[model samples]
Target: MEDQPEHSVSNEKSTAVGERQLHRGDYGAETELQRHLSTRHVTMIALGSSIGMGLWLGSGKSLASGGPVGIFLGYILAGSMVWAVSHSIGELAVLYPLPSAFVQWTGKFVSPSAAFSLGWAYWFNYILTVANEIQVTSVVMGFWTDDLPNAAWITIFWAVVTLANVFGVKVFGEIEVVGASIKFGWIIVVIFSLIVTSAGGAPGHGPIGFRYWNSDPFTHGFKGFLSVMPTCIFAMAGSENCGLVAAETRNPRRSVPRAVGSIWLRLSLFYILGAMMVTINVDPHNKDLFGQSGTNASPFVIAYREARLPALAHMMNAVILISVVTTGTIYIYSGSRNILGLAHLGMAPKQFKHADDSGRPWPGLVLSIILGGGLAYLNVKNSSADVFSWLSNMTSLFTLFGWGMICLAHIRFRHAWHAQGRSDSDLPWKSWTYPYSAWWGLIWCMVLIVVEFYLAVWPLGLPPSAKNFFSNYVSVIAIVVLYLGARTYYRGPWWIKLTDIDLDANRRFYVDTEIEKVPEKGLRGKAEKVLGFLFN
Candidate 1:
């Protein structure tokens, strides 16, 4: 659905005003991006991005090491922290609705140097994520047959994703809507099927009611549980992408909050409960869960096979293949947008900022696809183990770093709001937890960083290796170098003062006033009523 103006000004005028406000600083004139994303688009994009390879494949790793109890608890802890971050971003996005979300906001509310560093680091993280997913696609395809080489599968999938993204935001939104629906529907089916099979309802299975947990709830021990935390965090890494797309969302004021609000449900149903079901259905010590079997070793697949449903197992693999491809597409979309945002901030070349008539940042998009797809070729050399491991380690750390910066930005934003004498009532959407929620997210991000570093130095099972340590902690070094280098070059304020923030810049004027909802009166009305919580 196209966004209708809530006030007298046309969409074009409102966009022009927003661009003018954003151009007030040294960043110069900002380009306007078309807001093509609808409520369903934003919501499904966030859902599709979050519920991908991490939950499908990485959960097997977590389950093997941490066991049933460890992963469950780890997900709880991580889910709480992620919700805090989501809420913080939702509030900020509703008010600011900037293209790059907190990456750019860090400059306005925190420090320009910080934004520069965070933007590049986070952009790199997405690029690696794209490659990682593509690599996994090879493994997923291998489940069927090795008729094609790994590189061939990689090339084919990469081409498909590039084409999908070439058509612009509407196509991206539609792809996500379809992909997320399939993923969501399959997960529900798998969860229910697991429950049934565990109850001896399947062809050849006896009741398996929490047998794994009863025998070995914590596989390795406390240390093993600690190892699961990072995986849990990675599972939900892209949850915040909803905020990044807010600027391109047709009605962010109404859609963004609803999308963010649903995150808690996504976490609860998808990860927490799904993890619980996996533990109940499959033993933690199941050797086929990981290792030599690869992505085909997902616990859900194992569960289906155990229930004597080989056909369904194959179907599940197909769904997972689609899920991985969709996620790679999202990472590419997000990476290109990040470049556009960097250009808007004058951190990247102006050429990268050029958007086609359809609002596609074609230059950045091509660069992102080339880099992401190019990196996937590392698998052909049989060196993906080393290359992708380093990439994984760096991306995971950057996820925490990005969240920390976002929380920090939200804190500064609240400070500016109060310092400027703006009432809480003026906020389009207020975070009920406010200071406490942002602090929770910020503190937990720091704690996870320390924990991840500790895990790197002395990994769960193996003796410490300098190589392993650096591989895990390398992103820290990268972030530091980027921050210091940008800090030196920009030579802006070391920190932005609360009163110095341009709070009014990029603020959506339409949201500040009340708008009436036009009630529908047919099948659409019933669907709207059913999904009412998805919009204001």
Candidate 2:
């Protein structure tokens, strides 16, 4: 947070000079952010961000509110939204390869005021996510014992994440690759365990073949289904962080597309199918599904506990702890870069843009730690489940709003491309679904936001609570205030004209370089290709 820059009038020509003047002051000439992340590193970063606590801990609430069928549908709808937004972001990032990703694009393609809202909104989203990850990590630890306080565990992992991010992008990327690989393997184990236990393969369980669904498919009916949308949105929040790191990757043109391409597989295998298995093995109406102590909240753990498999339950909890801590590291890495991007665009203080020789934005990193890490102390005063509920609600709302803006920015970019007489063949990587996918993402995201509004007003089986209403809708209110305040201070237009949009700034790096493709030839090559296909 820095003071707003004073607005100034400029010419309305199609030249770079006019465009740069219209978008705050000229873009900062120096950007010391290094491109150190490899293809594998970037791919797993995307995977690691999305495959964390939302599925492990928060799914209990989803299943409790909406039964088996309701939660399944929620995952499908939310997965589709993530897919559409991923392609939109992929196409834009490959073309622009800029420092801030879609946040800066809103200023260039839409308006400066919109970019101001997006940049700060996205930064805050990650900050809240940081706290959410920490709280959940403590909850996961409860599965073992409550020997130490949640606050003690919070401080320990906070230091771990902070140290990981402080060393620069290379260190962070390496850690993510390892952490994400472990998580990937653990999910496969969980899915297989669920399959086995559901078929009566465990010691003391009868066959569980859709028995829960037969009893009650939809727990609370249509309203209950609507209530799960926000949690679904929260579950998929970090998938977009892949494209945001384009500026820090070694070869964004190749790495970003690979990362984006694999998102569909991740969603289908990890989220959608994972939901199906959870509902099959664990009863949605079980009282253990609503545990507030976090010890028995995860349906996956509950399923194993009921099946007489304590050892497996313990193993699953251990991996969940690792996954939560890994996610915390990602939020800090992404949050710092977001603020750095804001500074580069002249939307924040110049000092925030400062980077060390190793390309670490120390100032922004410190601020992220203070604000995001500080929020974890809320668990000291309230139950872990209560803290998780409100934090997830707030973060999910912000994510849905940010996603809608991303799709809008993409649509506007296409308009500007055609208006400037640019050919589609000149593009390095094209979004196969173009206008249709962008529209799909935009409309559905808006609908989900509206669903969030409805659920906030009347929570599942309870009257409207002032605390609940604000906890869920505060993200919407904050963004509106940020947008109006920036717009008033800058005296900018509501939207940029298509003909005057700046489509060429910071794009020469991607447009001028030829895409080099290496052919696969030997055993090593084949092995590498298989790994790339699976991860990248």
Candidate 3:
């Protein structure tokens, strides 16, 4: 690809010379992205990204390795940690409405070293995520036919998502909204089915009633718990896509917070409780999670099969396919947004920041396609199981690392806010449990990282599995190299101090919207009145 003049450092030099005369609260007056996503769009996007193939398929591994207590406790703790991270991100996104969203907060509030590692690390995470999603989708495709090569299916889906992204975020948001709503409802159905069937309502099992938990509850105790943390973390990877999309969300103060808050409900109801079903139903020592039964390795599918519901099992497999494809689309959008963020922050060539009139960042989209599509060919030699394992380790490690950086950045932001003598009243939204919550979240992140490291290098102080060691720590190696390289080139401070933090550069204070008038008592009122009474 030929480099264009618009992307040159010379171009940045000329553009930097023009002074923008702006008053207070006008720092982010204009953004290249269109804020077309409504509250429903943002909310569903978050749910869609979070409640996908991870829960449907990956939880099998979580249950197999960690057992009942481990899966339950791990998700509970990780869920709380992610909630804290999202809350911190919500506060920052509302205050500074810009492209690249929270990744830029690391530069302003934490350190440029962090921004460099986190910004590209997150991009890499999503790039690999897109590839993983496609490979998983192809695994699901095998349930029907292996006539089309895995690469063929990967290319087909990749092209579909890229076309939607090119059309712009409006198309992307609409597609995700519809997909998320269906998957969200389906998760509720699966949960209800699991409870009912486990109680002997489905004919094959007579009140299994947490038998798996009572018999072998904690598999291999804590060491086993540590081993599965990466898989559990992988299942929760895309939750942060919400904050990244805040740049294109309408009324981010409301949309982003609503999206962030919903994560708790999603995690508690879907992930944590879903783990409960797997632990109660599927054997903790089950080998299916490693795809012994192919992509239908989902314990949920196994549960359905056990309950004399082969059709239901197939239906759930279809849902997993749908979920993986939807996640694939979302990750493409997320990965492109990260590159766009990097370019805007001057870490990438300026050309990547260029968006079409439709508000699509063209070059960033191209880069995402290249990374995702190029990685898809890995499926040709290695099976989806091998590919998923390798990708999960990196994605999980970097995702947790990204979460840690978010908490660190927010801690610094809050410190500076207080140090500057600013009132919390000036904020659009305030998270509960201030400094304590941030620290609580951060401590857990460190715990997971340490546990993962121990599980990889020494299982109960035993020798490390050379394969697990490298697979699990690849992301850590990448981040260290990236941080050191960036620190060497742009060395300044190990940490950005509160007093020196730039809080004004992107202080986007939105004008309050007029409230909509209430509808008169009539057909509309009758419909809502009956619906409301039934709902109440």
Candidate that scores best on TM-score: 2
| Better by TM-score, candidate 3 or 2 | 2
- Give me the runs in candidate 3 sitting further than 4 Å from their true place: 1-30, 292-296, 459-467, 512-536
For candidate 2, the per-residue lDDT at 437 reads 85
Residues 332-378, model 1: lDDT tens digits = 99999898888888788889888888989998899999999998888
Q: Give the TM-score of candidate 3.
A: 0.89
Clashing pairs in 1: none
Per-candidate local distance difference test: 0.81, 0.81, 0.76
Descending-lDDT candidate ranking: 2, 1, 3
lDDT of 2: 0.81
**RMSD per model, one decimal:** 7.8, 4.3, 5.6
Ranking 1 against 2 by TM-score, winner: 2
CA lDDT, candidate 2, residue 1: 17
Better of 2 and 3 by lDDT: 2
